[model samples]
Target: MTGNGGGAGPARLGWLDALRGVAALVVVFDHSSATLLADFRRELMPEFNTSRFGIMVFFLVSGYIVPASLERRGCVRTFWIGRVFRVYPLWAVVVATVLGLGLCGVVEIRDFGGQSAVTVAVAHVTMLQELLGTPSLLLVLWTLSYEMAFYLLVVALFTVRLHRRSATIAVTLAVLAAASVAAGAALPASALSDRVGTGPLILVGASVMVVAICCASATSPVLRLFGGVLGALPALVLVPFNGTVPLWEGLVILAVMFLGTAVHRAEHGQGTWWRAAGTAVVVVGCAVGSAYRYGDGELFTRRGWIAAFLAAVLTFGAGLAWRRRQLPLPLTGLGTISYSVYLVHPVLLAVIDGTVGRARRDDPALEAAFFAVLLPLCVLTHRWVEVPGQAWGRRLASGPRRKPVGGPERPLLPFRRPCERTRRWYP
Candidate 1:
């Protein structure tokens, strides 16, 4: 996920940058451990799923900042444009790099199972491949599916003017998660794909997404509303029935994000602290209870998942409470490159694993070396790839000097730019 904003200058949101940096490192460690810290990984994973911990933090960060970005822009067309540029360029680069490496025999990509090249390509293009029954070429990409779903749902809520109902939405999703478990809604991964065939589902999903995005971006009010509602339908359908993760956890992920929005609302005076607090209580309780009831997965223990979930929430709360404090440059810099680190590390690891092979034992030295290598590369990618793309996005989203005949695009709500005294709140 992206940190506060596009530019990597003096970060106004140092706390968030620090959090993103911390989460990225944890995720890197989680993946790197498979090769470098095998012995300790066995000991660590059962007590703490570092992957879950890191992703939950990322999701929270995205939840907090992404909607703010959209609302700040106050135009669906520009919001989509910004999101496209912010996400896709780097994604395209990474995907192509992986494919190139695979072709060169430098890294063996994940098998796409029985899916054809056309299907896999289209699914990945949609960024909902994980939910569309296509195995991600890069394992880490699975989280992006949920991130995309969150984006869709956010747009839907914003279009409908229900965005302020963050607390209610969070509570509803959490309750649904709990209810899913209680009702024994145990669907296998990709159940929809299994029934309808992966090709058909992918085609339909991609078509709907295209229509939804196009219509939402259209100037017509009716089209925007229809598109918003239509866009949300796929996510609402897929996350519950077709995700690789269990149904309850998919619902919980969305709940966690909206809970972040609730906190944002509370801090900005659009909502009350007690409402945010109560929403958190319901979300955390339901998430923990759902995990406990769902029992241990093959990779993670119930206790570990519960612990990680609580830790992520607490970490976010701590970040928010300490948002006013100045943070170290190094930490914020890491966060600036956090998205690059998240996407690039997997490919790096793949190359290393393919060529050098996994370490024979818990080699802390090797792990340290991997980070030493990874960080510099990620910093370079961040500067060269992410910064330029975001700049272009910002330029495009700001739009042409000549205004259209329709007058200025509709504001999501009349938002006065925060005065200097209130700048920190915006950050």
Candidate 2:
């Protein structure tokens, strides 16, 4: 049943990947509306499917999976290495590429390209360009910073606990969230964020709430259902006039995730019907607001059904077969380099649209054609430069490894806590 390397792991959760992949594309699609479906997407669908929110879905998946990996891998180092590999190297390449282009004068030198060696080194190496207000060479790196912070938090917590304190340690973070609001701190909202989305304390609180909820979820179904409700409720907050929400809303996002993860854990029997429900919630809930804002206000009066259809299919449209471990190569490829793909695609849009789009202004057909070509090229970049860089990062962080039980000896993909074992962590 297993291959030489245990056939690249077991029935790989194609659904998670496929779902994540869809989430990414939906965000893209929603953004594309900025061009093609301009009015509809920016207004009606903005809340329905967003890149930031899609990323949160992956975080939910990660929150669920990381614990399992930790259980099998047996140490924090492996987890750290895996996370580093997954993030930095590819990022460095983008930073370098932007710099390389700046040197060549092929691209315009935005403020991010400064004249000093220290400036370049610190910005690129520390991944602090976003904080410096450099208009990130890669627009998506902001989220990477938050993700890195999340990783460091995980490592720090693990180190302090030494697997000794209860998982309950995550509880104290909630008070921090409340305090962030009180202190008026700037914490990045999601893993991919700018302006520190919320505040560190608030972020910590969200993480803690997430951890607490997940710990409870493993053994409780009711909490899971409650999570579903929490996740669904956020659709309401995405209003037509929500010009600015309090920083505290980020905590709400995390709170929804807490509920979402819980619900996902306790739920099963995935297929068409369930997918439809989720899609409806996201599409109707989010897209309606988007279309109402950006669209010509003809959504219900004109393209109402089309907006609804796209939202449903895009949001909750699940293909259970995609969840199988033996994922299709495209999906697998995307999953493998998703981080890179996410980072590169935004820049790719700016570049491709700048080049191809300038020539085809007032021609939506041309923009679509260029987008089609760009998507594959985008994926290839992920496969080559970014993927390899991430691999290098992991190798640096990694100490070496042991095999996952019943699996061939292979590099662990970081932590995913398991349910069966309580004290098997150090072994």
Most accurate candidate by TM-score = 1
Model 2: per-residue lDDT, tens digit, 1-427?
Answer: 0000001253455555555565566556545546555555546642344554565555544543443344344544455455545556566666677677667655554553333554535444444333333345555565443333334333433433332111222222223334444555543322322333323323333444344334323324344334323322212221101112223333323332332323333343222434434423442333333334333444544354334334433432344334444657666445554555465656555564444443322446754774576568767777786657556754554434444566443443333232222212322
lDDT of 1 at 176: 98
Task: Give stretches of model 2 more than 4 Å off.
Answer: 1-10, 30-40, 45-49, 112-124, 128-135, 162-246, 249-333, 353-364, 386-427
- Cα TM-score per model: 0.93, 0.56
Q: Clashes in model 1: which pairs?
A: none
State in Å the error of residue 29, model 2.
Answer: 3.1
- Candidate 2 total steric clashes: 41
lDDT tens readout by residue for model 1, 1-427? 7556433245457888888998999999999999989889988887888999999999988887788767775567777888888888889999999999999999997887879999999999999999999999898899999999999998888888787788999899999999999888989999999999999999999999999999987766788889999999989999999999999999999999899888888988889999999999999999998998898333255877888888999999998988878888898888889999999999999999999999997889899999999999998888899889888987776654543345554433344222121121110
